[model samples]
Target: MPQKGSRLTPEQVGLIRAWIDQGLQWEEGATFAKAPVLNLSPRRPELPGDEGGHSVDRILASYFARYGVKTSRVGFWIDFLLDACISTRLACCRQ
Candidate 1:
């Protein structure tokens, strides 16, 4: 049968053909049927908040402490505001 857009290599195709030629033997008690379906419903996961701060900050606390990187909400807001102002000034200048 023609398999359009197949990604199998020549060696892999050869192996498959050999297997088919050899009567397609299977291990005892093994079947190729699909396994039972799992419950895939969406659910909110409990975010880790060990330090009583923002979930993200608490999660990254270990990383920050390990790398000696200090973090503060005030510093974050200041950097964000500065970046916004710079972007606005550049856009206005380009107009």
Candidate 2:
């Protein structure tokens, strides 16, 4: 087949055809481009102090006030935990 202004060899064509016949199985973690080096180190973020209730609430107080987003710490944690659980379940199901 013609590729990048050049024709593929007969052997290359045969190999491609065989790959297609075999359901186009790709090698695990295989990539055409170089994968980026990620720093997977644990990080401890500086959270706001318990001056206005929860640390998250204290951090988001200005945001809540600005946007008129009325919510409780209990509600926030429940939603966050539920979302985390669902995400964890989905990830486990995929594996």
For this target, which candidate reaches the highest TM-score against the unseen true structure? 1
lDDT tens readout by residue for model 1, 3-85:
77878899999999999999999899789889989999999777565557655666677778889987774346657888999
Tens-digit lDDT track of model 2 for 10-79? 9998999999999989999787898899999999777665565666677777788789988767447857
lDDT of 2 at 88: 100
Q: Give the Cα-based TM-score of candidate 1 against the true structure.
A: 0.40
- Candidate 1: where are CA atoms >4 Å away? 1-18, 26-31, 39-50, 74-95
Which 10 successive residues of model 1 have the least lDDT summed?
47-56
Each candidate's TM vs. the true structure?
A: 0.40, 0.36
Off by over 4 Å in 2: 1-36, 49-52, 74-76, 79-95
